[model samples]
Target: MRTTLSRRSLIAAGASLLAAPALAQSGYPNRQIRIIVAFAPGGATDILGRIVADHLSKAWNTQVIVDNKTGAGGNLGSDLVAKAPPDGYTLLLGTVGSAVTNQFLYKNMPFDSATAFTNVALVGEVANVLAVHPSVPAKTVQEYVALAKSKPGQINYGSPAIGGTGHLAMEYLQSLTGMKVEHIVYRGSSLVLQDLLAGNIPSTMDNLPAYIPHINTGKLRALGVSSAKRWFAMPDVPTIAEQGVPGYDAAPWWYVSGPAGLPPDITKKLSDEIVKGVSSPEVDKRIKDAGCAP
Candidate 1:
């Protein structure tokens, strides 16, 4: 099973909200097209981006590359795509932050997400897992919360980006439980995972896919998942709501988009190809193996 929430369900939930305005362009992607992944390589976003790129490359007989542009909580890369020509040659594998949440999280946004780009396709959703290094004593979500409450701001947790879903999920958890922990934000999930594995950081609430192997290998201990219910890939792990906090859900979605002014014809082509690419047998298994719903 891919997820409790299916791909169609996620599309239904997010597509309308991300619909973009119409404009001009033609011939679609005749040359090499670039898909900008605004996070470091090896994270869920980057992995999914490459999956899309590979599929598109074969399907369209064009070279599709994934560029990792990391900075400013994904705004740097997002802004780059926003400012690029709306010819469908340059695209973005956008996360929740780059698409929606960063506007509210940041004081000054370089581009207006409202009109910057056209939403090509809603990729899928992934739950952020709240995991800690073995050094931490906490074994469950309640224990982790109690530890944080006792230490207050002393406990530090690493997140992929400032306004990204991982960061926001942690913020949401703190708000619901009144637990205080210092935030150690990184440019991407790989860097955060690096620090966490080396025991440089004690805990993290980040995308579950990147941490799954370590969690299974005993390098990390998963306290709880940030989704509303148990994740299909990690059903043994409980949700935060089940552990202690009720009604806690912070799953994040991914999508493909290009700059605004893309002609309706080009936009439809891109969206159709993306949806088809992700649904292919190979890509679908890859997404599910990455612990995301496809």
Candidate 2:
């Protein structure tokens, strides 16, 4: 038989558990918070992650650090967060690549979005632009399809990686048009952009923000955007679906999430703070300037 604890010991233990909720509800984040970015530094995701971190640090009066864990197309970093403690101290600035598309691409993932974490809030949406080098000889989506059909497998497109949304979006486009195009994977979007500008790769589907300035300067040609509705920043361009590929829409989105089993009070506190931070006018303008819809 187990010995019974003294009344004072039992009372202290019970009080601690009872105080947990109260302490958590007092606007959590009383300590340092780590926001993991599942990508390398200097990319759009990293840049935006830093922006959010700065805002959160200022608003919460606590240290908000960004830790980049880039590998396996953002899987390594994501899995890290998925297994972290369910406390509010650790958070993930997850991307569409890590959250939604990876589920369809990977055979065995370490975590499931629905069960591994709680969605804090949506940060922003990055539209994919269908762009090609000037030598592709296709000015419109229909013309591009005709050209690809006529010379099946002759046209090649590049993406950040095989399982990235850029790759899947192009694959979806190919399925819709019944056209064949070789897929080329690059280290990152910057490398892809470098090759596209140099006429090494004929075409690619990438975040519009990366290529928007080039498109504006006539360095690259934008055939269409991936959003169903026209982008507010680039209203003149039509969406890929509206142009011809029906039901075609894809964009990389960013959101905050914490590991499963997080206390409701902590989860709610984080969600409210993140949503408020992303909704601020300054952050909204920065996101819009990046050619993403926040």
Best prediction by TM-score:
1
List model 1 lDDT by residue over 235-280, tens digit each: 9999998977998989988888889887666777787777887778
Candidate 2 lDDT over 71-172, as tens digits, reads 777788888889999888888887876667777778888888668876566677777889999988999899888999999999899887778768888888
Candidate 2 regions exceeding 4 Å error are: 1-21, 25-27
Please state the error at residue 175 of candidate 2 in Å: 0.8
Q: List candidate 1 segments past 4 Å from native.
A: 1-26
User: What TM-score would you give candidate 1 relative to the actual structure?
Assistant: 0.92
| Candidate 2: residue pairs that collide | none
Residue 230 in model 1: lDDT: 93
Per-candidate TM-score against the hidden true structure: 0.92, 0.87
